[model samples]
Target chain A: MKIRIFVTLKNGVLDPQGKAIHHALESLDFKGVNDVRAGKLIELDVDDGTSDSDIEKMCEKLLANTVIENFEIERPTDQAAREA
Target chain B: MKIRIFVTLKNGVLDPQGKAIHHALESLDFKGVNDVRAGKLIELDVDDGTSDSDIEKMCEKLLANTVIENFEIERPTDQAAREA
Candidate 1:
């Protein structure tokens, strides 16, 4: 099975990389871009038996820094349905 | 309005960061982790009038590297319903 994990900075956290991108956008003449925040997307291919809770445990143990980041998991099959 | 851009490496492209993460997970004893790939998620706050085509233009100009990356855009309100 394929799983996707999105790790994003928590509210109020300072994101220097995001700031840099925002600046880059402004310099590129892209107007009306009020703010920008950047995060990580980690895709994993695991055994079919991998349960949802196991994935959550993986996030808590290593995938995310809970102190300053939050994570959301998605299955590609489910995501495709939503996209359609 | 809020927009999300997911940038991922194209297939066949080498991803050292992803390799490192996979190694880390193995060392941590997380079984069934077959493969891992890492990418970026960029969130933007823009004016409500910002058109979808304009956002696509942003991706082409600076948000994503067309040479080895692909980007997908999503609006928060639309995503919320899908999640529910």
Candidate 2:
């Protein structure tokens, strides 16, 4: 089975890369753009029996640096409904 | 309102960086780890009434380079309900 973890900075954290991209977008004449925050997405193909807690542990231990970011998990079954 | 865009390589795309990370994990003595795919996550704070269509336009035009990756969008409302 596959599990996806999305790691993002908490709201108050500063994201320099995100800011640079935001500035570049404005310079390119794209209006209506507001603020930008950047983070990482990590996809894993695990054994089918991987537990939810194991996935969480993976995020905490490897997929994310929780000191600066938060993570969300998504399963393929949930993603399928969203595909529509 | 907030819109989050996740950008990931489509299947069949080679992700050397992800492979490197996977190998690193194994070297670190973490067993049972299979493969890794790395991607980007972008978060945007927008006007309270931004439409789904506009958020999608942002993904296609700015948040992702569709030539190499695909993107998915998540609205705060949807996210909240999922939190439960």
Candidate 3:
């Protein structure tokens, strides 16, 4: 299975990277961008039988820093097609 | 409007970060893992009128390194409900 994990900063956390991107966009003359938040996308190719709890455990153990970040896991349906 | 940009390393690229994560997972005793790839997620809160072409330009010029990275843009429908 191909699993995708998105780890984003908590709402109140300061994101310097996002601010840098926003500033760079302005410097490039791009307008109307109100806010920007940067996060991580980790794609894992695991065995088909990998359980959801195991994946969540992976996240809790290593993939995410639960203190200031939140993560969401997605199992894309297209993975089956890709593997076929 | 809210737009999500997923930036990932292209195939054949050497991702030390992903390798490190995979190694760490192994260290944590997680099994059945095949591969891991790390990427970036950038969330943009832009004006409702921001054009898709404009967003694409942002990716091409600054958000992604076209030579080694691929980026996908998604406009989540839930943004409407979130803004409500």
Candidate 4:
């Protein structure tokens, strides 16, 4: 199964990369950008039988640093139908 | 309005970061992992009136390197209803 994991910094955590992007956008003359945050989108191709807990373990063990990062897992079965 | 932009390497492009992640998973004894790809997720807080073309411009000009990467833009209006 295909799984997607989004790892984002928790609120109140400092994000220097995000701040840099925000500055770059301003220099490019793109207006009205209130804020910018950067995160990770990891795509994994795992076996269909991989259990939920196993995926969670992956996140907790390696994919995310629990202290300042939050992860959200999207299983193939949970994905909403996309519009082509 | 909130907008999400996902930037991923084009097919056939090398991803060293992804390879490192895959190797780490194996060392940790996680199995059934077929492939892994790493990408960037950028979240922006922009004006509600920002036009689609403007967002596209942002991606083309700064967010993504069109030669080796592809970017997908998701507007708040395009999001599917979530279960919460």
- DockQ class, candidate 4: medium
Q: Write the per-residue lDDT of candidate 4 for residues A1-84, one digit (tens) a residue.
A: 889888999999999999999999999999999999999999999999999899999999999999999998887654553322
Q: Give the lowest summed-lDDT range of ten residues in model 2 chain A.
A: A75-84
- Lowest-scoring 10 consecutive residues by lDDT in candidate 3 chain A? A75-84
TM-score of chain B of each: 0.94, 0.92, 0.90, 0.92
Across residues B1-84, which tens digit of lDDT does each residue of candidate 2 receive? 777888999889999989987886677665566888999988887777677776777677777889999998888766765554
- What lDDT is obtained when candidate 1 is compared to the true structure? 0.92
Interface RMSD of each: 1.3, 2.2, 5.0, 1.5
The lDDT, on a scale of 0 to 1, for candidate 4 is 0.90
Residues A40-81, model 2: lDDT tens digits = 988888777777887787778777788988998998776655
Instruction: Give the lowest summed-lDDT range of ten residues in model 1 chain B.
Output: B75-84
Candidate 3 per-residue C-alpha lDDT over A1-84 given as tens digits, one digit per residue, 9 for 90 to 100:
789998999999999999999999999999999999999999999999999899999999899999999998877553333233
lDDT: worst 10-residue window of model 1 chain A:
A75-84
How much lDDT does candidate 3 score? 0.91
For candidate 1, write residues A5-77 as lDDT tens digits. Answer: 9999999999999999999999989999999999999999999989899899889999999999999998876
Tell how far residue B59 is off in model 3, in angstroms.
Answer: 0.4
**Tens digits of lDDT, candidate 4, B1-55:** 8898889999999999999999999999999998999999999999999999999
Alpha-carbon shift of residue A47 in model 2 (angstroms): 0.8
For model 2, what is the C-alpha lDDT against the true structure? 0.80
> Highest DockQ, which number?
1
Best by TM-score: 1
List runs of model 2 lying over 4 Å from the truth.
A80-84, B29-32
